[model samples]
Target: MKSSESTNTGLVVGKFWPPHRGHQLLLETAAAQVAELVVLVYANPAGPGPAADRLPAATRAQWIRELYRGDELAQGPRIGTTPLRVFALSAEGDGVPPDAAPDDVHREFVRQWLARQGIAVATVFSSEAYGPGFAQHLGAAHVSVDAARRHVPVSGTLVRKNPLATAAYLHPLVAAQLGVVPPAAIPRVVLLGAESSGKSTLCAALAEACHTAWVPEYGRTLHEQKNGNLAYEDLLYIARRHAELEDEAAHKARKVLFCDTNAATTALYSYYYFHRCDPALQAMAAVCGQRYAHTFVCAPTVPFEQDGWRGPEALRSFQHGMILMQLDFYRIPYVLVEGSVAERVAQVRRALGMVDDA
Candidate 1:
């Protein structure tokens, strides 16, 4: 028989290492039977064990809120009226001893902790078999939801073991935190160099060779759209767009995302045209170097072709030196890609440890 559910307030407690669909189901089921539902998310800031794998506690609590708050819960008509209260319990140096098993000692500490918060739980919900004993300790009836994991067919253990494999079972927000790269794991390669240094050509060739997605230079788009009249303010916008495009391409990449130009190159241009880089552009440049798994610095072996929009062709080598210095300053590792397009592509492939199937 199902346990008593006629209660004013109910609670569902869990570590929520990475909140999954199973947790969502348990919460929705509990909220359906109670007027108010208090979700006590147990977060271990110190990272309890290998099971946790250093997933942030605050992020997990936020995931619970994201899953249960307002319209998110409205889909379930029963959960709509139930006022959900989300709270965090730091499992590190908290109520119960760390070594204590999930028994009366742990349940009693949680019961007392809830009591101290002026919340008198009349029903307790959980997926574990020990829910009844835990509820009894708090003088509340236990409402077991998916005790056999038949409903959701997913668990924290499965998720922790391989988040990317079980990405479908996790909320978008939680999955993002666990490094579950949507689509697949793809190495991002940014081709950073001076103007007319074959960066665009090399990026396209690499993308084609690797059979991956590529992000074209956003600055070129902006320059074309604005008729080449670029202001200092536009530099930051270019940097921001570069990052956005990289993120977008990463989702579609097969094994690598090739970027024609990155934020560092944008910052260099800012200084080249405006005599200085904006603080915002500098910040973008600072972070841009790390965004790519690998960067290829194009050597100015090919003659600089002034495309009407470019600066003095004479400054190509100087600009190449500046790009190299910037990479050094950021401590970003990069390979100098010179010679022909085929040679540059081969160099990048060797660095990435890709066997030439061709």
Candidate 2:
């Protein structure tokens, strides 16, 4: 069932909207058998909405290249550096069956594209039920790694459905590919507050005034994507991931990173809503306190908007107090940002010791 001994190039095809562990396992297994691997990322612009939800084809290709750019593939006489080839395939008018099943049409189109590139595809790797038949039709061998029977065969659907439960199944490499790396150096100045506290607006102005980079809040974007029904756990996950990403971005910047919020905010938010905090959330808060050089608490000023995903203004006010209390308990240095937008931005620039004209 597993090819542990073989030396031939292979082709693996998938939508890989957001490549997960199952996909990575199949790719690694196939790479073991193949002398080289060509990963064909298929995108049908005219297909249903599900295909559109995947990361853009260009972004997916970048993640794949970053994942395998310097990785060593094989060992021994059969040992050689495994080179990963990422290709973007468009099936607009390639003479392929238009009404065929999406997967089938995609596989056939990919085969034709590869042939035109002068590259012979010996095998196709996948674990889906339809993969074997599709591979056979293309005259390429089929390699399927039955991860379904494994303990952690988490699917993209399952993760999208309940991302919190499957966070443990995420591989570091995949996380990095997804732009979720912990920063090598921590930002000295961090923002901590509840939703609708004008944290993002203030952070942006501060970053501009100080000539530093700002890590935009990812939760709001996720909220908009989910139409405001995102669970509290998803918010927590996004908060944690945001901190990791902020650190990564700040590591390369010359000045402090003006982050919108940190994991502590998530811990408080989850506890407020669920009546308890997840242990992982508590640990993350502890790590955050030690990671940041300074922390700023944004006071809830403007009336909260009941965006599809947001609660009422009264609830936001309560959450703001809870967040401040949590910050106090953690002993993190803090300043409160308040007043009009201009005043808040001015205060932030002053706190960070940046010279401003007005």
Candidate 3:
């Protein structure tokens, strides 16, 4: 809450449980009017279930800071306190309200917090029901920016209920929060296979051989989170996000990246699990075919070990067949990788025409 004496200062307030496109638009609009903008991410304990139910206030502030750190619009706005200071505001008295509305109480708390920090707010910016009135209470100009009609509206409730439905409307900040990055320049190579196929092992080897980056399978992480039994949609979402991370890593990498798996594998897995296909899965598979430069199919060479999350041998065998069918259907050329880790690494080098000396 350290104050800066900038001539034009604006304060934006929100729960920002998860900062989204709507938040970005409001901030963008406020920046146009102010030389400096102070974004206050508010946390209220009196209104909601548990404070933990919402995204942490610190995390929300981080999203705002990251979104504006190098962004064009953020260059002039002075969005936060520490140069790029996105502030975190919390209600006082355990956030319990005696009589006032929770929003009003939170606003009053914010004003007190700013005063304590020796900061003066000139304007309050927001896109919420309580924004204008709160601004007036603080002796600041009020600006309400509408998010419903401008761009795609993004809401935390919508995202929590249906991430895929709102994924398209998510801002870059939200994508980053969810570990998604935009496509990069490096070549993306995906490794496809069933569980216990050593795809992850081979990916690490290939990355080492080429001195490049690799994206580990997020499915395993998701599987662990779900206590072993994952739904078809969960697998599909992880696969799609894995591909996205690969693209992002590729951009940051020197030459190329090794992806542990791709969307085609996910689509086939979904089909195998549900005996049907979803349009999102299909679209993801199609997109993967165009994005990957090469795909390495790890032939099922070993028996299914009792990995904490892996299925039985029968399921692995079935998944293996489905993978092959997907490759044929997509018409994507894939080199079959078999044998030890060393052998797989050599095959990858040969495929990419990169010799040890090179």
Candidate 4:
């Protein structure tokens, strides 16, 4: 039966620790049967048991919202007209019954919680065999979807063991959060150096050689746009937009993405000019090291070019030193690239374990 007890809403509940397409199938199926659906995600914020492996409750809830209610899963185009309400029910410190508790006990626990929340439901949707019994306990109809997993052919264990291998069965948002790089996930190779250290030239050449995509320094473009007159606040905007540009290029990237510079380098310049750094920009710089698959520090060994907006050759050297210091402070590993653009390209290729022309 698709639905019953039209006066009451429908309910679907699960840990949704690492939700897969199977969960989506259940949700869509449930929504089809009711005027409204409420998904209650459960997880233990503090645990030493099976729930310890579960993603945080808030995180799981966010994943559900992102999949069904946000962006790509935006309203009106989905399977059902029923609005879905999603929230996390903390298993810890909430008097919720343990998973091992008897069915009667667990059902009572859910009943009390629902009563407290003032939520009434007539249908309990699930993929598990417990659906019918659970629903009967709540005086609701049981609408089971794919109990054999025939439609989805995937499980939480299978998805967790090898997320990358089973990405097709998982949403892009879930795969990303679980650290499973999407097929379209481009490896970002970030180059850090002083101005006129050949980062831009090398970035373009490497992208061409690899037949991929490259992101030019947005910071420099923004600097020029502001006529080289920047304030402390401008640094945050530059760092943010620079990252956004890189992300935009990543979608069209063939195998990898080459970035001329990163947010940390932006922070260096920010501190250099204004002696201050916005907290948000600082946070971006702090995690910037982890964002790149490879880091290349362009050496100032090549003669510095005299761009109209550039500082003296001495300033270039000082900035190079500062960049290196920042890398060491953050313990970010990087390969040093010097000489002509072609030579640097070859060096990068060698770092990637490809044959390079020395």
User: In candidate 2, which residue pairs get closer than 3 Å at backbone N, Cα or C atoms, i.e. clash?
Assistant: 8-35, 228-309
Cα lDDT tens digits for candidate 4, 123-171 = 8999998889989988888888999999999887787677778876765
Task: TM-score for candidate 2, please give it.
Answer: 0.49
In order of appearance, the predictions have TM-scores of: 0.50, 0.49, 0.52, 0.53
Task: Write candidate 1's Cα lDDT for 1-358 as tens digits.
Answer: 2235544799998778778889988988888788888887764333455635444565567656644433222333235567778876666545433534657777878878987889999899999988999999999989899999987898887887788888767654455456553332466778877789888888888878888889999999888877888877677667665665676777888877888887778888888789898654565577554456788898998777888888787788898899889889989888998888899889888988875734
Tell me the tens digit of each residue's lDDT in model 3 across 124-204.
877777877888888898877883445646676776565556765565335434433334467778898888998888888
Give me the displacement of residue 287 in model 2, in angstroms: 1.9
Task: Put down candidate 2 lDDT per residue, 178-293, tens digits, no spaces.
Answer: 33323345356777667778887787777777766788777666667666565644644565557556756765665677777777776666676677765445656666665576
Q: Please list the C-alpha lDDT of all candidates, in the order they appear.
A: 0.74, 0.65, 0.68, 0.76
Instruction: State model 3's lDDT.
Output: 0.68
Off by over 4 Å in 3: 1-183
Whichever of 2 and 4 has more TM-score, that candidate is 4
lDDT of 4: 0.76
